[model samples]
Target: WSEPRVWPLPNVWLGVSTENQKWADVRIPILLDTPAAVRFISAEPLLGPIDLWNVNGINAIEPDWIGGPTAGTGCPHP
Candidate 1:
């Protein structure tokens, strides 16, 4: 048996949501390894700080877009 391979798909976008460095560190690498036309991070409700520039001591891999909820302009909160 052979390991599964991931291939880049047309018009496919992949993303992960991270509120802080912890989750970013955990999820970003996996997202980077996956094949996607575009990769992004959603920091909605940004509960804490995150540093995408340096994750897992690697100075590589960055999301195509990093977006978060703008003050009073995003999804309604309870």
Candidate 2:
């Protein structure tokens, strides 16, 4: 999907899972390389903000927009 976004909209959107070995997490770089006018990241299901050790890759994505991670936890207090 790195073949330069062909979409009419200049904005590009991506969802990155913080969990290691996930396809979305690994593919973000290639998507970032697309040269879209704008880029954003959806952190839903974030699995908690990823550790700095693995943050370098995410920085490269340079997301233009950000979203809160979807809470995986269910209702509290049984």
Candidate 3:
């Protein structure tokens, strides 16, 4: 069956994973625009830094949740 045209499905939660700023920049916007009951970001195995507040230079949207390793732990610094 084809995907539904109506977005922001009632029960489905959508998310994107990013290892660093580069991928975040590439993926986050797409995820935000696509509709879902909930939206999230996964920064697991974080290889570098990311500034969610500054994404797209517009500060237009924010994820419902952000998950990843704690600071000074799994994530590495530049």
Per-model TM against the reference: 0.59, 0.37, 0.61
lDDT, candidates in the order shown: 0.61, 0.43, 0.64
The collision pairs in model 3 are: 8-36
In model 2, what lDDT does residue 12 have? 46
Model 3 lowest lDDT segment of ten: 57-66
TM-score of candidate 3 to 2 decimals: 0.61
Error of 1 at 54 (Å): 3.3
Q: Write the per-residue lDDT of candidate 3 for residues 3-53, one digit (tens) a residue.
A: 655655677767777777899889988986776677777776566767775
Which candidate do you rate higher for lDDT, 1 or 3? 3
Per-candidate total of colliding backbone pairs: 0, 2, 1
lDDT of 2 by residue, 23-75 (tens): 45576676566555454444434344333244332433321223445444321
Clashing pairs in 1: none
Candidate 1 TM-score versus the reference: 0.59
- Cα lDDT for residue 15, model 3? 74
Off by over 4 Å in 1: 1-6, 55-78
Which candidate number would show the highest TM-score if scored against the true structure? 3
For 27-47, candidate 1 gives per-residue lDDT tens digits of 888888876767777765555
User: What residue runs in model 2 are displaced by over 4 Å at the alpha carbon?
Assistant: 1-25, 51-78
